[model samples]
Target: MPLDRRQFFQASAALGASFALPAPLLAAEKGKERRIDLVSSAFTVALDPSGASRSAVWGFNEQLPGPTLRFRRGERVHLAVKNELPQETAVHWHGLRVPNAMDGVPGVTQHPIATGGRFDYRFELRDSGTFWYHPHQASFEQVPRGLYGALIVEEEKPPSVDRDEVWVLSDMKLDNQRQPVEDFGRILDIANDGRIGNQILVNGLVAGSQRTLTIRSGERLRLRLINAASARFFRLAIDGHEARIIAFDGQGVTPHPLPAGGLALGPGMRVDLIIDCMGSPGQSFPLRDLGRPPATPTVLGALTYSSQPALRSKPLASAVTLAPNRIAEPDLAKASDHYIIFQGGMRGSPVIGLVDGKPSRIQEIMAKQGLAWTMNYNAQHEHALMHEPLLHLRTGEHVMLHMINETDFLHPMHLHGHFFRVLAVDGKPTPHREWRDTVIMGPRQSIDVAFVADNPGEWMYHCHILDHAAGGMMGTIVVE
Candidate 1:
């Protein structure tokens, strides 16, 4: 059964309402600094055009899709979050390499901010790219209720384009009356695919299905695509056009043409594309999800050309290369190898796992308000967010992690505070080794990633599947 609003609040409130300590006292550093005041509250949104079919959702500053926060590459951000919701909430700056204190995981990094409490987050932006922010406490509920926003870190020397736009993609489960359904924390959903929504949204509008961008022929565009959905994986393609994938997960990569099969964006992932309008005037093209059923290819958006002659008969001739961030390459020859295995999630099989250094079973965990998932044999209970580190490493150590998935589902694993190079999958070396903050692990798959632990702090490594992570598939890495 779905949890009622009061029950959801009770569960979120049980996360504890302790205040976080003040950010480190550092001199107001020089750089582009800005103060952003964000308030979390409930708002009514019109999912349909009639305005009668509205959904009550939680949002930042009473606006769905919150606000687009823009910053420069080396700016200092001082963000103050005022919680107006009925329960506690904290924001995690997804994909940003902020200090450990500003990572925003309740109990693990900081305490949850209570109702009507205000928390200040101060951090310096190191790398400029596409990132996002959302509540970390009870995210399985808060995020799905519409509490996420886009964060853009402008490049020092950005590429030239007619327009630079951000497309925040999301999904929501709705009832017959167009109201958001309340089936959060269902056991079956937690064990299987985590909360796949029925309706797809782009920038908080159902109109995304038919939204059109008018452009002149031969004009160049820069599109920043963010997958903010809780669990949905989007396989997208732009019909009648070719897009060059320049960046992934906020990290710049060697520019390459997107595959004909399209790009796959899992939860917590981002992709940057540079595309040129090639279609003739008065012609229209669609940006669609190819993974959906043939009868219904989810049309994310459209591109319509104006009645103007082409600037040049052919596409843009200039070759483009993005500036790479300053990240140390892993020394694979001297890398220390480690393994983290995923287990459980069987229908009839018993979930035998460990919770907080104690032996526990699936029934026991469920009875205590927990889900059935684990990483390295450790399952975190609902009330206890902080757990011992899975492994401790010294700074500058290059290590290889073999993430083995034994379950029957896909898990997009995300590592905070650092990006890792994907070396191999299923023991097969990759042709183009790429760096990513989040890697999708398929069923019964084994992926090997190498990274240098240069960041000095306790960072989180967990499944991007919010429900699974909340259930127990989360751990911390301590680099000293």
Candidate 2:
């Protein structure tokens, strides 16, 4: 039977509602500054197929999901990491700018911190917002199982809020025995969409529950949402309350009212929203994801109002009209737009899809490298350039890159070391003027991103889905 559009939505909603859960973990307090000592050690934990439960690892601070390292912007950040894992490892301060040497890109900036090694990451917090850290080596595996955490850089002049909560949404793939499913870098790509799993989780639990909180009416609350899933894009919304979007990807932005409709969150993307609880005095407002299926409740969590005196008529603070960072806007008129098609399937069979007109052959490459993993239709092999695309631009030239999605799933396209503005969609002007480091492209859809290649380096442009990236959705752009 063909799936009706409405019926499809209903089925998806059912999948979403399969579970509702209580807030899974304890949240950190506002205005608290602390030091962190993280030890990345290798250990084994039990796993069902989905790899969702408390599995074994190689993790930071000896725990999966690593340790939550909290610090205030403008304050000194002291991170002492000790590695006990068998292999050498390095921590890349994803989305944070410290120093080139301290960037921790393993081969690029610093040497890998070997087993029983200790390294100190010391830097001044220049930005106040949400960020995270994970291994730079084998990041594809380390981050998927465990070894990642929230690196919240708090604002010096905190927002006028009574409380704040940080939520990291992720997914897992388990085997039939309910243990973490693993291909261990040998699975055929064409049979599945890279490393996507069957189980979905928010901060480490299945859906169909609630994360409850209490706040006085009229008080302001900040909700920081991070999509840490390896290969999922989230459409997040709060049930009854409206959330004003204040930032993206850790950079503060001009505010936009949300919960009027929810927002889309890509992997490596972050949104900070402020909600007022005094609207109905005692109403229960759940933060929902209208983007998901109806059967599956979109409620990320709930914000309950306490019986406090309502300030008759109080309005939330309007967005601050701050200029974007001091950077020159690129001239789009004279700039060139590049079109890159994301296409592939089984490795050696020569399926029709190719990135720029070249098929990715797993066995061919493995024969050259003496490896065992052969490419299936979707082998994550390198989709190299026949000739490097001319990407270098004048320091201030504005250029648009059109990404066309030809696959069955979503791809969170990300650019390293720089950010860009969304100029249009399918050739039409962008409805929302938001700047981002990563943009999620849906099947059959096209997106245009504008950016000035100001930061010069051999930076990577790839799918943020680590598995897809490993299979070959990876490339580099040189900014001269």
lDDT of each: 0.80, 0.61
Error of 1 at 110 (Å): 1.4
Candidate 2: tens digits of C-alpha lDDT, residues 1-480:
133435533443333322221222222332342345666876544322233445544555443455456676667655767887777788867667465566665655567898889788877666667777777666567676666777787666666666677776766666665566665444354223456556555544443235556667777778777777665566777766666788787776777776343577877778878776665556676665565445454555567766777653575664432234434465688667877776543422333423234553444533342221211222234323233532555555567788876655567787766667877777788756567777888765788988777765656567777766665665556666
Predicted candidate 1 versus true structure: per-residue lDDT over 152-219, tens digit per residue: 88889988777787888888999988788998878777877789888887777673535677888888
List the candidates' TM-scores in order.
0.89, 0.75
Candidate 1 off by > 4 Å? 1-32, 49-51, 207-209, 292-296, 347-351, 356-369
lDDT for model 1, please: 0.80
